[model samples]
Target: MLFRIKSFFNLKTKAKYGLPLVLMALITSQTNAQDNRSFQIFQFPANKIPTIDGNSEDWKIVPENYIVGMDQLWDDSGKQPKADPKNLAVSVKIGWVKGLNRLYFLYEAYDDYWDFSLPGLHNDTFELIVDADQSGGPFIDRFHPNPNLTNTMDAYFSYHGVHAQNYHIFTPAVEKDWTMVWGSQPWIKNLPYANASYKYDFKPGQGGKLTLEFWITPFDYAGNNPSRAVESILEENKNIGLCWAIIDYDDVNKTENNGFWNLSKEHKMYGNASYSLPFKLMPLEKQYKKEIDAKWSFKVVNMAKREVAFVDESEGEITSWNWDFGDGTTSTEQNPIHQYKEAGKYVVILKIQGPKGISQLSKVWDVAVK
Candidate 1:
């Protein structure tokens, strides 16, 4: 139930009569119909969801496989300008998590300065361009006009003092003409289902670094609906196009500097291009099936009277545990203490349930009578 811009309302007539209630109802119903659509599946290796607090401690366990460096991006302005390495020498580590019907992003930007004073394209910002439908035709070109294109979406974010501002690009146009979906405040306070945080470094000598964490639904864009409600744009399409860029502004010369992580030279404009890399957002349940490998060790506390206590030191998310005391008796406690009537050589077995199904480990223990 994709709602094209033309089918919904006439842009010219919005000022005259505004959007009719009937048309609004139609768009909402179509968006709701997307619930039955299939979604792309992805399984993250970590179980703990990352907190969107501008701190990346939760991502320590995850691998930083996606690396976007400043050197890889092209100069769209064609100035052939040389930028200070101290400010431009930056890299970004990106990780994705899909949960609660929303997409989460963990971005770590390594830079020298964090500036947020300038306005429009002159400000230090992180930009994201996405093609929700992946229909390769009318791409987003900042310098060119392609009104026939409607699938691309763009977002520009900057941190200013205690709050952060997100500038959303409604159409495939240049940075100067792009409209701010959320108004007035320097911070993003009006977005319905979006949240983000950033940590900036102001210390000298050591390059400034920032950790940005945020989450948004696929339908959380201005083009989708005027209300900006949570919808399944990703689920409706299954595949999407994506690219990111880091913009740096030099206040001394009033010039713009840009760097990208995953964008191609042809599509290196300040907005999303229809002809870009494709990404599939899959369901977690389909990718969560695997056999768990059990690893554990134990410490035995002797009671000195044929009684001993066993402590479980295991890794991973263990749901249930089974312990065998070697004397034809068993217990379901994670760590259980067993007392034998007499001294003997016995084998202890531990069976645990984890993400990878069931696994067991065994060790030999000797008990002496006091």
Candidate 2:
């Protein structure tokens, strides 16, 4: 089942009739807090949990924040002045979702043609290069003269005709030579957890689109059993290095163009210094906590009979203060004393502005007439 974290700033208000609705909108916009040595990949929270059946319907509700364009490919030899016309015409949208303990991805590509007859990387394929540890150290370079597994994991999906196959390239800790692991494994699958169906569509004319979805667990390069439990990896690291690319075979036996998207300027055969981007994986609970903790704290004290003093205990710098005293009255003072004409219980809300963004707090105070 899909779980959603409610917005911390959206507080339920209890207001009497004929009063303007007291809306305290605390917008907590998250900035990329991780190191920005390379491009920072934002893992947007999924709204409509995708079924991973390759259908594009579920993705319709996802916000534009989760979508990025992969319309051009980097010239590896530095010979081509720009991405070839055959490749430039292709548009790719990449979406990411974090579920339970697994990471999900949806790759949608719009191309004029789709070729699956060629073998290996030469065919229509999607390559995912990941640095699970984000160590930024030595890794297995696919283009290296002696390519052996180091600290990188490469997953390749080749679509030929009606058949599709999955392949993984990594160097096992026990082995010195780089090993090419193929077929379905426990760690990786074409569908989300192998239970969902893979979706695909092809049109003969222009504006053809292809969509694919997959998921992966956490993997450790140094361990004997490299694939570790998702919980362990989450506990150890909050970010992972990732990059993706799409290979297009425009003509029947010729590799026409390669289009790259997100992370990296040049397509690194295995892993490149420019290829990996630090992707911050925020779980739902952590996200909620971060939003709630960013708020300010204030308390209400009975200054006198039928009167109360709102004390602002917020630290650091505050830009603005907005208070709604529930009795059709409001205040913008940092600390304001409000009086009640009649004995009753009222809900007091305070909205404060800070460096991170707006935050809110509320309390119910009882006023007694003298």
Backbone clash count, each prediction separately: 8, 3
What global local distance difference test value does model 2 have?
0.45
lDDT string for model 1 (21-91, tens) is: 54675666664333232223243544667777878786564433344555555544554354446656544
Q: How close is candidate 1 to the true structure, as a TM-score?
A: 0.47
**Each prediction's Cα RMSD?**
15.8, 21.4
Across residues 269-333, which tens digit of lDDT does each residue of candidate 2 receive?
A: 33442346656654343442343222323434553456777677654467878888878899998
At residue 104, candidate 1 shows an lDDT of: 64
Give the range of the ten consecutive residues with the poorest summed lDDT in model 1: 155-164
* Superposed model 1: Cα runs more than 4 Å off: 1-47, 78-85, 93-99, 119-121, 136-191, 203-207, 220-224, 227-230, 233-238, 252-262, 267-272, 282-370
